[model samples]
Target: MSEARADIYARITNEIVAAMEAGAGEWNMPWRHDGSSVARPVNLISRKPYRGINTLALWIAAHAKGYGDGVWATYRQWVERGAKVRRGEKAATVVFWKQIRGRIQETIDEADVFDVDDGRPRFVARGYAVFNRAQVDGYEEPDAPRLPESERVAHAESFFTALGIPVAYGASGAWYRVSEDRIYMPDFGRFAEPTGFYSTLAHECAHATGASHRLDRDFSRRFTKQAVAAEELVAELTAAMILADLGLAAHPRADHAAYLSSWLELLENDRRAIFTAASKAQAAADWMHARQRASAAQKESEAA
Candidate 1:
């Protein structure tokens, strides 16, 4: 990578690392799920979700400020929408890929190549500032917490159902049966707390993502403290992410909290472990979305 590109990557990764370190100390991190909505931070300008590292960056910012809504906009974008940022509200930094002018190293014919390794092509990350809707006025928030509990559960059930995993209730513990390719949980009624049932289910779902056909997360070298800890960390991160996607609180429970020391040890030993775990967790979430999109396409095909 070019020095410029290396700086961009290092800068983003370092910021995330710093946030995680700070949150771990304060217990103010996303793991606290606390039912805070992790809805996509949409750009008021385009109504499109921010991508890649920007998503995590904005999420950290919103959670830090206790922003009620995930809506965001550049200063100009808010103005264009006839909304104004409240004075003194701070802005969060985000970045996007911008292409520099000029193309390079294209061969006009199959036989025409001079060694053109020195040619320059420029694509770099450009930074900008945005304010969450909580910092703005004159525009109504789009995502109000209006979904009722029963309805919310219904939606959650439907979304997981599409993953096509068989979930069987009635076992001593909640777990994914890897050998049988099934999930087992204690009866739903046994979960006394409101979020317990969904949280347990989400954890199992994350484990299922490691099956041969999905993310293939090999935890085969188990029995060691580190191996088990790493797998648990992945599932914890995965459940938290999916819960956020479901607009539910994602705080850590006893199970997720139990491994804090292990998690911190692993992270302290390797600076990139958290990022690797996050990327893998995202792949698990993407697997669910892939099923969702395919199901939609099939329905359309049948309708047509």
Candidate 2:
């Protein structure tokens, strides 16, 4: 990797790691906000949502600056569209992977390297500067009408339901059963707040990412006390990601306190643990969220 690419990776990992460390016991991801979370940031010109680490980086930038919307564009992109970024407004940095010619090295066949119809190219992460529409003066914000409260709840419920998981409501302390491939929760009426229910459910859903057929989280098979703690840490981070995506408040459960010490210990032992856990947690949440749409599309295709 180029030195610049390496720096981008290091900088992103360091910032996210520090944020996660500070929020160890608090159960808050740095990107979360009090109100509706911004949807994934997208290129206003291309109409494409940012993906992977760029998604988290832009979200963190927006949350920090209190950007009210998720639309973003390069300074040139803004100019192209006859919009101007307000003077003194800072740009957010996002990285995209670019494919380039592979480097040549000794002990490898030069012929083999060029054998393909097109020479094999290696992907490197490249960073770019962009401004959110909220930072641009002339750009009018898009109308993002929210669903009604009842419909919003129904949407969240239906999204998960279509994923085809067996969820049972009861007083089982609210957890995903890896052994049985089931989720247990208190009855809807028992929870004092609906957000609390979703919070707990989101955390458990994060754990489901580690199932053997899925992300295959280590603790799913080992089940050691330490592994369990690590897994819980993953779930906590995942819950934060999900809540941020759904625009729900980051309200961790009362039992969140129990994982505080474990998290601190884990972070202390491994400086990069938080970064790893946070990235995987995002992946888990993304998997679940993406499945919601994929399931819907498949059903539509089948009906046709």
Candidate 3:
């Protein structure tokens, strides 16, 4: 690896260590819920990545208090209520919401939502919001605009290389790096713009972070539903942070809806998940930033 790349990797590693030391425990995996005892092929939208019990409990409390729409406020309320229940101060209750065309509508359903008085009040739901019911709309564009092809490839290559991950172009805008010399990048024609290209590459880089030689996350092992959610949460947040640092707007994709339950559940289950994910994401951003900086320094050094 080039000295510049090496420096980038070191900087990223340092940032990660510092973030972890600062009590970044929110990355803990979440629980998963299958609708039935028999495992079936579940689509992304229907798949519940977090444990049903914990999630249901949270849903009930939040629903009863009518606090799902506001992201930060809902999270804060859940944490406060969750602590009460955990400490035997309040009980859990399940409040059912009607399912209307993939959207979770607040309704009275005895089977869907119920309350259980265990230590604290706990609420459970069979399922929360479905697709198309809740939409994420914002003032900013969903994705960053495209960049020049050459710039995209150069950026992707430099970004991964700095992390010590060798990636080459592959078909359909995909990227892969199995070994030191074996790396691939997909054809750019597969994507309409550079933002998509970089976003896809960023996802792959996140996977590389878990490589045996690196963070060794071992995603292959069947993670508790929560753990997988947590990792994905880390990946998404990291990608967004990196994208923002790169002077690009990180737009939410359609698939993000698939993890809504898990996201909410993880946050509710662990009050620290948001901060932890943010810190890790910041670490990833620092990593990418350091790499770019190193590259610039090397160019200046050569000029000097």
Candidate 4:
């Protein structure tokens, strides 16, 4: 990587590390946000949610700056929309991965030359500056429509049911047993708050996605402390993404603080660690969504 690219990685990683440290005492990660403006950070024009590291980066920026919404856009995009970024308002950096397009020359028998294509496209990170809606004028942040608590709970239930992951309730603790390919949780009434049940379920379900038959995202082969911490971070971030998509809040679990030190160590040691974890978490969340859609389609087909 070039010096500039390295700087981009280090800068974002440092900021995230700082955010995590700041929140460790309170047990709130950067991604745990109130479902106010929208579930996830989105472009003001494209209406598409930001994914992976960009999602966590924007969430940190929004939290630090006390932004009331998750709408974001480039300066040019804001100007094109006739919205003025307020004077002296700084921008946050979001990285985009662009593929390097070219081929390499290879010699054969010292007589012939061939241009051989690389097996896979190589991607380089580029940073872009974007301002949140709170930093702009002449545009109003839209109110996010919310479902009633009961309906939202039912929606979560239906979503998990569609995925069809087996759940064994009435357990003393919550976890996904990869050995048995099942999840165990206490009964519904045991949770202090209804949202807690769903949030914990999302976390466990994210772990289930890492099963051999699912996303196959096992980091346990290393059998080291850091590896375990990395997998936990992936599951935590994936759960945040899932809850955000469901338009629900991610309440912090009291036990999450145990992994905070390891997470900080990982991020500080390798600048790209956060990026890799975010990518894996995003992939897991995407897999869950795809499975849900496939299941829903199958059900519709059967009904028809």
Q: What is the lDDT of residue 268 in candidate 1?
A: 79
In order, candidate lDDTs are 0.64, 0.62, 0.44, 0.68
Look at candidate 4 and tell me the lDDT of residue 137: 69
Q: Determine which window of 10 residues in candidate 4 has minimal summed lDDT.
A: 28-37
- List the candidates' TM-scores in order: 0.48, 0.48, 0.40, 0.51
List ranges where model 3 is wrong by over 4 Å.
Answer: 1-164, 171-185, 210-225, 250-265, 302-304
Model 2: lDDT of residue 112: 31
List, residue by residue over 71-128, the lDDT tens digit for candidate 3: 2112223333231112222333322433333333343433543333234433433433
State the lDDT of candidate 2 residue by residue for 264-286, as single tens digits.
Answer: 67667666666666567666766
* Pairs of residues clashing in candidate 2: none
lDDT of 4 by residue, 1-304 (tens): 2355334334433444455766655332222223433468988788888899999899889878656567889999999888899899999988777665456464322323336466666555668899987677676434533323453387788888887799997443467888999997755654556666777788889889888788888665542557867787777766656665676643334334433554778767766667777678777777887888899899899999
| Rank list by TM-score | 4, 2, 1, 3
Report the CA-based lDDT of candidate 1 relative to the real structure: 0.64
Error of 2 at 91 (Å): 61
Mark the regions of model 4 whose C-alpha exceeds 4 Å error after superposition: 1-18, 26-152, 220-225, 250-262
Cα error of candidate 3 at position 88, Å: 55
Which has the higher TM-score value, candidate number 1 or candidate number 4? Answer: 4
Taking the tens digit of each residue's C-alpha lDDT, what string does model 1 give over 1-304? 2355334334433443454555544222212221223657778767788888888999899768756456778999989888888899889988876644454354332323334444465555667889986676676434433224443377677778888898886443466878999997655544444466776788789889888888888744532446556676677766665665676653344344443443677777766676666667667767776888888788899999
Ranking under lDDT, best-scoring first? 4, 1, 2, 3
Instruction: Output the better candidate (1/2) by lDDT.
Output: 1
Best by lDDT: 4
